[model samples]
Target: MVSPMITEKVISNAPYAASAVTVIAGFTVKDWGVIIGVVLTFITVIVNWVYKHRQDQRESALFNQKINHHQKHKNN
Candidate 1:
């Protein structure tokens, strides 16, 4: 007996990069889940890096302000 094939609809502009995929090569649903997970993890890492960079810039500005204030007081 032949097994029934599954069909999924995909948008042309989907992030997966493919309009449609046919799974005749024994690629299972589990494999697709892993691929998606990896992509999401990469995106999360980039977002975290940007957030930390902004935080560091803000801290540096505050530190510079403190140093300038102390220098002005010492000169007076």
Candidate 2:
């Protein structure tokens, strides 16, 4: 999917950057429960990040639509 931030100045090559960062950051399999718990928490963070991002997007879209609709009738 095309990112919402790509422009003429910067490519915003995010998938490649994300994979590279994930690999370099060493977010991989672990041997112990404590280690796994840490990884799970990290995973939780990523999940929450994506969820909040999408939620914010939805909320903004709804708010914009509401304002547009309200203005359409209020201008009459």
Candidate 3:
């Protein structure tokens, strides 16, 4: 039980949808700088991760030394 008015409206918009798809499909990427920018962005993230890991290791070692010193003082 389809209405003729609704069917006409849908049929009219079908060509526009196809045209929009064609336009989008024809688009192209034309930039070398953008590709290089993405690569450097990932490199910066990796370097930051390594630096943070080393900082955490140093902090953990310092905390352990402090705890050992406290235990030695308490026993004496």
Candidate 4:
């Protein structure tokens, strides 16, 4: 099923492939810096979300304990 013409074309273009690959793969310094910035921003958002979730859970537990204590005193 393979064509000889296509194989010959691929062999002819193979010599220039490295330069083409480098041009595609080469990221500038600014590109790397922006990528790092975006990653850090994502991590910071996740950490803040987890921290807030834990704080809310702790506050809810304390509130429940306070309500129970007050109700017991009122019943007596």
Candidate 5:
């Protein structure tokens, strides 16, 4: 039996496939601009959210350490 071969060229052409479909569907320059804007905005929001979450985690850890240290010294 002969199996299908999936190569790098085929994988890289995936974007072209989407472009072909969009072209066939008559997407204009303005449509592409809106799509690009929305994608960039979504990516930016996700990056900021991830950064803020990590910062909060770090601050919480530092606060816990300070409380623990103060308690230890208060008892001495």
Candidate 6:
């Protein structure tokens, strides 16, 4: 029974409505700050882990190449 225009409006306003509800439900500014900080920390940790993994792979490859070169020269 809902019209397309009404559905669009509700979807657009959904975030605002949810935010208002959370405030009314006693979610204070400090709670939001802590939530944001925790999310940022988690994202940072994931990024660092990925970077370290890639670096380790590069070092392993380089070491293998050096070992191969040394072995080839030694066999000559």
lDDT of 1: 0.77
Model 1, range 1-76, lDDT digits (tens) per residue? 4333322333434545442444334567898788889999999999999999999999999999999999999999
lDDT of 3 by residue, 1-76 (tens): 9999999999999999999988867656744467678899999999999999999999999999999999999999
Per-model CA lDDT versus the true structure:
0.77, 0.82, 0.91, 0.94, 0.91, 0.96
* Clashes by residue pair, model 3: none
lDDT per residue (tens digit) for residues 38-66 in model 6: 99999999999999999999999999999
Quote the RMSD, in angstroms, for model 2: 15.1
Which candidate achieves the best lDDT against the true structure?
Answer: 6
Model 4: clashing residue pairs? none
Ranking by lDDT: 6, 4, 3, 5, 2, 1
Error of model 2, residue 59, in angstroms: 0.6
**How many steric overlaps are in each model, in order?**
0, 0, 0, 0, 0, 0
Each model's TM-score? Answer: 0.64, 0.58, 0.57, 0.68, 0.68, 0.68
**Model 6 CA lDDT for position 53:** 100
Q: Which pairs of residues collide in model 6?
A: none
Q: In candidate 5, which residue ranges exceed 4 Å CA deviation? A: 1-25
TM-score ranking, high to low: 5, 6, 4, 1, 2, 3
Where model 1 places Cα greater than 4 Å from the true spot, the runs are 1-20, 23-26
Task: State the lDDT of candidate 5 residue by residue for 1-76, as single tens digits.
Answer: 4334556667789999989987868977898899999999999999999999999999999999999999999999
Clashes by residue pair, model 2 = none
RMSD of 5: 5.8
